[model samples]
Target chain A: MPTKKGTASGGTRRTPATGSRAANQRADAQRNRAKILAGTVTAISRNPDASVADIAAEAGVGRVTLYGHFQNRAELIEAALMDSLERGEDVLSEVPLDGEAAAAFQRLVASSWVLVDQSRALLAAAQKELPAARIRELHENAEARMRGLLLRGQREGAFRVDLPVSWLLTTTHVVMNGASEEVRIGRLDPEDAPRFIDAILLPAFTQKRDR
Target chain B: MPTKKGTASGGTRRTPATGSRAANQRADAQRNRAKILAGTVTAISRNPDASVADIAAEAGVGRVTLYGHFQNRAELIEAALMDSLERGEDVLSEVPLDGEAAAAFQRLVASSWVLVDQSRALLAAAQKELPAARIRELHENAEARMRGLLLRGQREGAFRVDLPVSWLLTTTHVVMNGASEEVRIGRLDPEDAPRFIDAILLPAFTQKRDR
Candidate 1:
């Protein structure tokens, strides 16, 4: 109890009302942000041109409150899109990596495919709102994670080394995004997405080539 | 000369002044439409949000004249995109398909890549303007040509048959589209795009896989 009462952390501090009330407000703000993000995804899913007012209504929050969390439509859309990706990152972080490179790639893609499908509308909204450079900047962390796995696969001689790793990464995105368009347009069944991705990507990555 | 006079053909009609005037006007209209479509492609290439006024100015046509040809902005963009695609179809139609399937795929991609690169901005414009189904409808002829080639590849056992031909077609699109993005962002060199596309897609199409 004595060691926990140090000046560093707010919960352990002496000012009861000040620290606790501030903490409570911060928690409330986080909860509202989460709600707004979820609502934005749903709103955009229903209508890609959903307004900020529409999102606020869907979130059951006032316009002022939504603005407090996000300054403008572009900011709000970017935040919502990033929030979904970060949530996917949590699942990606937990995927077991100690295995055959090909098997591990499959496991990672399986976890990711559903997230990609879920966030597609928001992703489209983000693309409309953000610059291409900004979008690429946001994808850096996700790209790095995949790059590491791909590098390991290449190192193990499990994946083709003739092509650049960057191009391979691009193909993965193309497949996932193309699959989204396929599912969106009813060209591809949603349930087949994960298997379809693995089927195309795994062989493509592991192929032996003369040219 | 008397035998050349016919009711069906315009040039052979007896009303000389009226017929020639209408014929000249039609040629002028065709030239204007061609100029406008080419200008639209260039305008969208410079700015995806190029306005009708901007496009008209680029084509050196009066706004009223531009409107006379295209009903609206959507119609203008669709026509421009379709025009470029039809131009590519000319090159695609000439690709000698009488050879080995893999080699023909390469030749077709080589012919198609630059056209795609050139028209990508207009495609983005079209995506923003038109519904997905409408865009697909416009792509029917292009898709048919590709389908025919890919079907030949699968039938000849030169490309993989395990995956559905439709999914294989999707993979080709994914690869080409992905390469464009790569080139757009300066991630892949423009000079290398054709080869890069060939490398990834040929293997993706031809790879024999366990899974």
Candidate 2:
């Protein structure tokens, strides 16, 4: 059969070209959003009262471009917070959840301190500026994962089942966050965080098996 | 003997009168200072940004009187912080520290939570508006007492001795403060604070004795 005429061939080629161009644009937008988010974390960490204009400048993006990616200041902060939490979750997901529950819990605590120490300033600013409900929303997934691990521990008799998992998870968050604050203020040595966490948190979760 | 009786009797009465008057004045001054400090705590708790005038109004004292007690706003805030810490220390002192380490620790945590919960706003404001050093200074006494108890527990084999007692005490403070923040933000139930503290903290300090 004879090939289609010039106009039909041109239509097929042009369609693929247009689709690739659109995909490239979408990827570029995502990169810019990531850059803006990273810049926001830096700016807010340096100065909790940093303005949108300051953050945009820090990102090396124009105000209009920043606004295009994030509608307003609150939205930008929320995005930055979500980005930080996602990073923490990425770190947390690496710890094996199926092993000896107490050992897994220790690994979780150690990995968590790495993220907590890194995000101290951002966490402080968010806790100060955001509402409790919004902060809790960002933490919901982490809490659920932690609760699941604790429940597994309890079922295996490695952890106490007397206390609610919710309280245990909340206590874990509170202690980790508090330790981060201590490190920030120079009250606790950063290197000692993991040991402190293991020593303090393990006993709280683990039950006396012989008993 | 009767010749000098009149003059000597008058002198004796005048000396006692003067001494009593000075003692009365000093006591009154202390009472007024206490009132102003209490008022400052209330005002700052109600609004972290409260002004000197607002505190004076809260105390039902004139600005002049308030200033007479505390020279300036920073001084007033410092005084208020010290006063709050003193109140907490007073409560802490009531917990018998010489008893079984675990039971005493629980009592300490319980009594401390009462003060922590009551002074949440004041503590938050102090942490925010003051330098870390100043806040740490106010906490020095409490830290000392906590360390003492931890040492006693370690010696008695009631608590883990492998970890530094200082770190353990710091973790205790961190967890308590975090729980207070949770209660303040309505994330954790206030009534559950004692149980949460026991469940989370007791194990952190208690040594794993043979059950």
Candidate 3:
């Protein structure tokens, strides 16, 4: 016999007591998408130039299932990259940037270190595979956000305005990239790496104040 | 009939009485060696992970000839990496560091920009493939050299002593790596990247005279 109007075959399947089944389907789709992206991250971490088949195999899914989600290797790689970036943005949004620019800078560096250490391989692959134009776009957006903070500090007389905002943004990216490389290569312990970042970057970004 | 002292040929058989023939052979060998190195540079510049077969194909030389000269891929790659490092060491050696510390810092940045820009791909590959111990050995030597200059500057009271010598080395490496990436992706002109390096690095390494 058929099931009830919203219930499924399972005796305990929570169905649309009020369209909850539709919500459950949506959650399942989101979970599947997350799984595919996670697999892509794993595959590309192993080999930056990994092909779509490699990603599919890692996900334990067929080529058609992979293609149904991502059209090609570039798309899959782009999605993986953007997913990491989006996660970074989310993390940064939660970080408080109040008080002295130096304090804010340290917090930012620490948070970034955590994110970079977690996704080191995927980040390296993105750098390798992403096109120049795409990188410029992403970098510019990040710079703008960072510059806004630096500008605020400058207006508050907490940062030196003699240096160009762009230079600060560029330099921060440089240090962060280096720290990430150190983490990836095991040159710096993931925990100790943040201390290095704090030591080097805080001094570079901080304005001198009378002690 | 025997020609000269050793062969059954009628004419002089083109054997020089002087050392010209041996000198000519030496010159030819040098020319072939240079060509092979140039080919290796090109191959590594394009693909740091390129195989010995790939280098041979790019160099337009037979596999036998390639192996006859280098013996194996590791030897050839090491030679290539060493050649690049020697060029950098030469640049470091020639820069006049006796003047103002900041001026000397600028010179270091300028020189490194040129070397790093040319061999970014090779550097990336070396980092990926070479044993970490060897890389650390070379890095330590470079650091010792930089440390001497930094110590000299600090003694002269023209530089900050708050940052460790290792931090300075890390900064320089980060700046070089950042500039190399910018050059590789065509975001910054090769000529213009040195200026970017100078702008970011000189200030970090220098005592803020204005402040």
Per-candidate Cα lDDT values, in order, are 0.83, 0.79, 0.70
| lDDT, candidate 2, B19-125, per-residue tens | 66666666666767777888888898888778989999988779998888888888888888887788788778778888798888887788888888888888877
* Global CA lDDT computed for model 3: 0.70
The number of the candidate with the highest lDDT is: 1
Docking quality level of the chain pair in candidate 3: incorrect
Which pairs in model 2 have colliding backbones?
none
Better of 1 and 2 by lDDT: 1
Model 1, residue B48: what's the lDDT? 88
Position B89, candidate 2: lDDT: 83
Of the true contacts between chains A and B, what fraction does model 2 have?
0.84
Q: List the residue pairs that clash in candidate 1.
A: none
The 10-residue segment of model 3 chain A with minimum total lDDT is A1-10
What is residue A182's positional error in candidate 2, in angstroms?
Answer: 3.6
lDDT value, residue A81 of candidate 1: 72
lDDT of 2 at A180: 83
1 or 2, which is superior by DockQ?
A: 1
Ranking by TM-score: 1, 2, 3
- Where model 3 places Cα greater than 4 Å from the true spot, the runs are A1-32, A43-57, A67-74, A97-102, A136-141, A206-211, B1-29, B36-81, B96-107, B117-144, B147-165, B180-211
lDDT of 1 at B53: 96
Candidate 3 per-residue lDDT, tens place, B1-211, comes to 1112222322344556435555555555555566677788899888767888999888777888788789877777677778778777877888887888767777766776777777788777666556645766765645676777778877787766655665667778887787677667665667767776666555566655555
Please, what are the lDDT tens digits per residue for candidate 2 over residues A118-176? 88877777766666579889988777888888889889888888877766787788778
Q: Please give each candidate's TM-score.
A: 0.83, 0.72, 0.65
